[model samples]
Target chain A: MRATTIHAPGDIRVSEVPDPTITAPTDAIVKVTAGCICGSDLWPYRGENPITEGDTIGHECVGVVEEVGSEVHSFKPGDFVVVPFCHSDNTCAHCLHGAHSVCTNLGMTVSGQAEYALVTQAEGSLVKLDEMPDASMIPSLLALSDVMPTGWHAAVCAGVPEGGTVVVVGDGAVGLCGVLAASVMGAEKVIVMSRHEPRQRIATAFGATHVVAARGREGAAEVKEITDGVGADAVLECVGTDAAMGTAFAVARPGSMVGFVGVPHGVQLPVQKMFQKNVGLRGGMAPVRRYLPELLDLVTSGSIEPGLVFDSTLPLDQVADGYRAMDERRAIKVMLDLQG
Target chain B: MRATTIHAPGDIRVSEVPDPTITAPTDAIVKVTAGCICGSDLWPYRGENPITEGDTIGHECVGVVEEVGSEVHSFKPGDFVVVPFCHSDNTCAHCLHGAHSVCTNLGMTVSGQAEYALVTQAEGSLVKLDEMPDASMIPSLLALSDVMPTGWHAAVCAGVPEGGTVVVVGDGAVGLCGVLAASVMGAEKVIVMSRHEPRQRIATAFGATHVVAARGREGAAEVKEITDGVGADAVLECVGTDAAMGTAFAVARPGSMVGFVGVPHGVQLPVQKMFQKNVGLRGGMAPVRRYLPELLDLVTSGSIEPGLVFDSTLPLDQVADGYRAMDERRAIKVMLDLQG
Candidate 1:
């Protein structure tokens, strides 16, 4: 089997690797059908986060259950499924409360970026589709594996409501998808803060009523101006930079929520300002496991095609080019076809 | 009228001042019946927060309406009432959403530790009791003016649930009151981190199931062990210090909530850790205006007595001693009697 490995920063390479097998009773062997380069993956790829040499790299995927251990239940051979980013027992108090991202048993059961990955707590982490999805539904189904549900969680965490003003801070696939989610959730005004013309247009197409190109304080001021000085009812901080976090905090009105999805880099929460303004912050990794079903239904019903975020696609062997394109800002998201 | 003014960091003096008249159509002048020192007041008194010399102090008071403005509808002359620390019109969208603490109309009204306090947005910021209470209920009613509701909001923001374990991170009157609120809200285990004997006993009486005297990581470890390594489901941060904030974050289970009511003093939030842990931070000055009615009901029905926090009382002429007692840690809270 061939897998992508990062020897160091800027040193991603495709190399032959031993196939993964079930190491735990709750583990399942999954043959990756499709995978993609996630924005979070770049955190390690760019060396911003520590990554060991030859570490397995992806956490988003649609796969087929090739085999399952004795303890695995609710899944079987030849089943098509979407794997949540975090593996959980599905029975812990936290998982029961629908916070699967912080699952207690988060061992590397399965990773989406590889051709074959071991999935832990198979019954709890795998969401089997009613049937094998049609070829046309591949992109959207793959999205449900992470991006769509993540965007949805960001919107949900921010408490975006019907007819409320929501500000999305980022132009990446997840941020663009948040615009769609806010719209689906009935926000009357979804503003995407993006300077890139192409991404801004995509944001508008995804139901952003307004677009502000400013960054930090300037961006927040723009949002306030649009909202008559009350700031946004909710803010989705899709980018984890300090500037993006500051903008999110500045733009939220008192008693409003800020949902942060970006893997925080080096951001410090402005606690004093946040408390004084009565602003609340709730968010972390996308609880994709909890939101996949509803988002999948939306995708199947044709109300949204979030897979549009994939501006380019490549064969699994060409994953390096995909990374380069994204790092260079040439693509919003790079979809990889494992079966190709 | 007499007002308590801060002449310096450690100097509080009761001085005769011009009587306040209705400055806005929504304002009302109240003859203060009682006022108390708040934990927040210590911020400037301790020289941690800068304040201008001769600045009027205090934000908690219970009083009788002396005069009502033409636009004041809910309050009239001679009505006994509890004034919300924040003066809000209650007509703005933020207020309608129950964020009276961030009301758009009021510009940060204060001046509570005085002979008379002017309340703006009388209809929204003043809560009237069914009748004038006997002198015994004064301390409890005064608690409702700030500390009691603030503590309740801390628990509420932390999302304390029935049978859940809650940890309170302060030992001041508000933190002590949080123990009572947590028990009242049905939390089976309320852990209070206190080393002070009086406060520890008060916390136990108020229903703290566990008490840990350690601070920082050691304290968090103790709390974690008590909850079977899952940490507390909710943490109430009633002390606005870096150490208290750290304890709140350290002792919280992943995906749990932390409600911090203490005005932040040099506390910084580590967003990276917070994001990975999936913790949520919510709190501000308790929207006492929102919780006062329900708490007053509990008081009127004899269900709870929050007055236990006031360990000392003084006449209005001895207001300077009240400040000194609180500042010197000789008293948890000092109530000022106007009639004396």
Candidate 2:
């Protein structure tokens, strides 16, 4: 098997790796169909996070179940599925409450950027599509594995409702998808704050009623101006920076909600301001598993096409180019065709 | 008329001031019967906040309406009323949505320390007591103006449910009252985190099932241990401090709520931890007007006694002593006798 391995910052390569096999009674072997580079991947790739000598990377994928362990009952051989980044037991109290991201028995068993990966807690981690998807549906289906679910989590956690005005803070793929989620959830006005023209176009296509190419206070002010000085009813913060968090607070109307999905990068919420503005902050590692069912339905029904975020695609062996293109801001998202 | 004023840090004095008169068409003049010192007052009194010149202080009171402006329809002369801290018009969109504290008009007519107060939006700010109360009930009635309602807001915002475990992060007057609020709201386990014996005693009397003296991480651990490692379902942060805010987050279960009422003092929320925990944070200046009517019913029926928070009393001429006692932690709250 071959996988994308990270040996150091800015250094990525596709190298030979041992094939995955059933290691637990609940584990299943999956042959990767399509995978992608995620924004979170950039953390370790930039050397900002601790990286080992040869760590296999990737946590998003659309794959086919090639084999299953004795305890796997819900899935069988040769079923195409979308796998959430986080693995859960599906029977724990937390999972029962639909908070699979915080499942009591959680694991990262599948490396998405590979030909074959092991998936633990098979019944809970894999969502089998009703039918085999066309090759063109691969990227969009793969998106449900993480990005789409993540964006939906941001909107749902913030309680975005019909006729509400929603503000999205980042221009990344997840942020763009949040605009799509808020729109799908019935938000009347979807505002995306981005300076990038390509991402702005994707956001608009996803139902963004307005786009503001400003940052910080100016950007927040722009959102307020657009909302008739009441600020946004819901804010989705996908950029986990101090500036991004500040914008999230500044642009929320009194009693509004801000859902943050980006990993914090030295950002702390201003409690005093949050209290004064009566803004509610709910976010963290999105429980993407919680939204997979509905998100997959929407994708299959053609109500949304989140895969439009993938501006560039490459073969599994060319994973390095996908990283380079995204690293250079040349692509909103990069798709890797593992089937080839 | 005379009012209590703070000329500088630690300098409180009772001095003659012009009698309040209606300044707006919706304003009314009230002859104050009771006004109590709030924990928030200690901020400016202890130099935590700047006291510029002789600024009149206090924001809680019950009084008799002496005069009403032409636009005032719901209240009139000779009516006994409980005045909310914020003077909201109640006609604005925000007020109509139940966010009276952040109303668009007349949000800052603070003259609660004087013998007579100019209350803006008389119809909205004054809640008429069903009947005039005896002198002994004045203290409890005055509480309905702020502390009691603020405490109720904290519990309600935290979403404390029946049979739920709730952790209160402050032990001041508001925190103590929050215990009563949680109990009334049917919380099964009300745990108060307080090291002060006085406040703890009050919390216990108000129905705190468990008390933890530890603070910050240690306090959170104690709460988790008591909750069987699941953490409290709701947390009321009645104290406005970084340590208190941190404990509120650390002690809550995932998918729970944290309602904070303490005016934030240099506190910053841990966004990453909050997100991962799936905690919902909601709080701010409480819309006391919204809760006063119901709380007044509870008080009038002899079902609750929020007045016990006032541990001391002083004549209007001894206003300086009242401030010193509260600032020096000798009193949880002080009641002022205006006629003396």
Candidate 3:
């Protein structure tokens, strides 16, 4: 099977690798129809995150089930499924408590950017479509595996109240999806902190009523002004950098929450300010499996077009170019056509 | 007029001071029936917090309204009222949003440990009782001014669900009050971390189902053991020290929230661990004015006896003894007899 592998920072390749097979009774193999690169993937590509010499990368995919183990009950061969970035047994304590990302039997999808991927705990983590949809729906469906659901997690954690104002502090695919989620959840005003025009257009289309291109305190000031000096009712922190974290807290009003999804690095939480203003911090790697079903419904119904974030697409064999585009900021997110 | 003043760290004295008068249209002077020493008051007494040579210091009191400014409407001259530690207009943006502690017109109670105290924002900050109750209920009413409502804020911010398990990481008056709040919020299991037999008894009386006397990781382990390897459904960080914060997060389950009320000092937020567990941190200085009405109803209806936390009582002239007793942990809380 041909799969995407990283040899080192800036060295992504697509080559023939050993095929993934059912190693456990709860596992299933899926022929991936499509996959996409995530903002997190750039961490290793940029050497910010340590990586092994060659490891299969990518955690987002929509695919057709090829085979399943005896114990897998929810999915079987020939079924179209959306695989969550993290697989979990829904019966586990954490999963039942709606913390599937930390499920007792939790693990990640294997070889997701390959022709075929192995999904563990398939009974709980894979969401099967009732029937096949148009080929064009693949990108949006694929998004549910990670970005869409992740974005929804941010909004949910931030507690975006109906008719309230929301600030999304990032311009990545997930951030754009956060704007969409806040809109869907009925935020009257959605503010996006983005400097790029292309991403700003997508944000506007996704229901962002304002865009503040300023960085740091300047951006926060603009949001506060828009919110009539009260700051945002909810803040979605899609970027994990220290500056982004600072900005998220800065624009949050008293009693509001800052929902962060980006993996934080070297960020110091503003405890005193948080304590004084009654602001809260909540978020992490999203429980994608828990949120996938609802978001899938909205995608299939055409209420949202999250696939718009896939500004660049390429064949699976051209995986290196995909990484480059995303790494160099030439693309918001890159979709890989496994079928091609 | 006589008032409690802090001369320096560990030095408190009750001496002659200029009598407080109505200074604003929103001001109301109260003839204090009872005033209490809060855990926070000990901060300056212990030399942990800086104190000026002579500053009037108490913020919790219940009294009869002796005078009101022209603009005061909700409170009358003869009404018995609960003076919240933080005065709020209850009409500002933050107040309307349920964050009264950060109200635009917010201030602190003035000279509450004296015969007469000045309460700003009288129409909004003071909750007038329908009728003056017996002297026995005065202490309980005073508790509502700070500790009880502060505890309720912790439970509310932690998002305590019906029939959930709750852990309170302190055994002070506020934490005991938290046990009561969690129980009232429908938690099936209430755990308090306490080492003192006296405070533990108060916790059990306040609806604590379990008491773990261990500190730090050991305390967290006991909580987890009691929870059957899972952590508490909700945790209240009533102690603001780093150890208490650590134990609160350590014993919390994934997807659970830790509501912190103690004034956090020298604490480092466990952002990475919090992210990985999907545990959230939310809380701060409580908005007492926002929660006063319901809590006052509970206190007055005999459904709750938060006054049980006041194990010691003293005359107004014994204010120095009250400070020493509290600083030495000789009492759970001290109630000053302002009218004696």
Candidate 4:
């Protein structure tokens, strides 16, 4: 089997690797149908996150179950499914509360950026599609595996009230998807903070009512101006930098929320500022699994096309190009066709 | 009129001051019935928060309406009321959203520690009592002015689910009040972290099911042990120090909330740790005015006696003694009898 492996920073390659097989009684073998490069993937690609020796990459994928262990009761071979980024037992105290992202029984699992990946806790992590989606639906469906659900989580955790104003920070794939999520969640005014024309267009298409090209204090001023100087009711922060976090807090109205999904890096919360503003901070590694079922329904019903975030796609052998495109900001997201 | 004034850090005096009068159309002059020294007041007394020359120091009190400006229609002379620590106009966007603490039209008002205080935004900041109550209800009603509402804000903002486990950090007046709030809100297990015997006794009386005497790491371990290795479902951080904040985060389960109300001082959030734990942080200055109505009802109905937090009482002329006692930790709270 071939898989994406990171031997060093900026050194990504599709190389021959041993195929994954069912090991635990609750494990299942999945043949990857599609996969994508994630913003998190760039952490290691940029050498920010050190790569372990021969580490397989990717945590997002749409796959078909090829084999299941004895204890896998929720899925069977040949079932097309959305593989959640995090594996859970579905019965742990945390998982029972719909926090599958922090499942207590979560253990090591195979990477999805491969021809065949082993999925642990299959019953809890795999959301089977009614049937194999059309090739065109593949990208959108694959988004359900991570980005789409993550964006939805951001909106939910931010407590984006119906018909309220929402501010989305970042122009990455997740930020674009967050615009869609805020719209679907009934935000009357959706504002996307973007400096690039292409990302701004995508944001508008996804239901952003306003776009502010300014960064930092100026960006916050624009949001305030748009919201009548009161700031946004909900601010979704998709970039983990300290600047983005500061902007999120600054543009949120008193009593509003700043839901941040970016993996925070060197972000120190200005405690006094947050306290004075009375802004609520809530977000983390989104409980993606909790939103998969509903998000899949939205995709299946043709209500939302989150796959629009994927501006580029490539075959497995051309995986390095996918990384380069995303790393260089040439693509919001890069979808990989595993079967190619 | 007489008032408590701070000439310098640690320099508190009860001296004659100009009598307060309604200056703004929305202002009301209140003759204080009972006022109290707060944990926050100790900040200036200990030189942590510098005291400006002749600064009148106090924000918590229950008083009787002495005069009302032309626009002050909420109450007339002789009406008893609870003065929330914050002065709000009640018509600002933030106030409309139940965030009275950050009201836009907020103005400078005389401190409650004075014999006669000018209450700004009277309609929004004053919660009028039905009528004068027994002498015993004075302290409890005074608690509603700040401490009780602040504690309730912590539990409410933390989203303490019914029958869930709650951990209250700090064992001061507000922390003890938090145990009562969490219990009233239906938490089955209300654990208070306290090392002092008096505080522990007050905590248990206020509905604490368990008391952890350890601080920092050991305190967190004790909470974990009590909850069967899983942290509490909600944690109310009532202390502003970094150590208390760290313990609050440590004792909260993944996907749980930590509501903080202590005025944060030199506290930096460990962003990475918070992200990995999936813990939600939401808190700030308590919207005391917003919670006053409900909390007052509880106090009136004898459902909660938050006033029990006041362990000492002194006359207005003995204001210096009240400050001294609280600063030396001789009392959790000190009530000032203006009439005496």
What DockQ does candidate 4 have relative to the true complex?
Answer: 0.81
Give every collision pair in model 3: none
User: B199-313, model 4: which lDDT tens digit per residue?
Assistant: 9998998999999999888889999999998899999999999889999999999888899999998898877877877788888888887887788889999989988899898
| Index of the highest-DockQ prediction | 3
The DockQ value obtained for model 3 is 0.84
Chain B alone, TM-score of each model? 0.97, 0.97, 0.99, 0.98
CA lDDT of A302 in candidate 3?
A: 94
* Location of the lowest summed lDDT over 10 successive residues in candidate 2 chain A: A102-111
Most TM-score-accurate candidate:
3
Candidate 4 chain B, poorest ten consecutive residues by summed lDDT: B105-114
The residue pairs in collision within model 2 are A283-B275
Which structure among the candidates has the greatest lDDT?
3
How well does candidate 3 score on lDDT at residue B230? 87
- Report the C-alpha lDDT of model 1 over A190-252, residue by residue, as the tens digit: 999999988998898899999999887788889999998888989999988988999998999
How do the residues A1-340 of candidate 3 rate in per-residue lDDT, one tens digit apiece? Answer: 9999999999999978899988999999999999999999999999999988779999999999999999997787889999999999999889999999999998897588889999988998999998886898988998899998888999999999999999999999999999999999999999999999999999999999999999988888898899999999999999899899999999999999999998998889989999999999999999998888788889999998899999988999888999999988999999999887
lDDT of each: 0.86, 0.86, 0.92, 0.88
Cα deviation at A67, candidate 3, in Å, is 1.6
The DockQ-based CAPRI class assigned to model 2 is: medium
How would you encode candidate 2's per-residue C-alpha lDDT over B222-329 as one tens digit per residue? 998999887887899998888888888888887778999999888867777886777879999988888887898999889999998999878878878888888788
Off by over 4 Å in 1: A109-111, A301-303, B107-109
Residue A14, candidate 4: C-alpha displacement in angstroms = 1.4
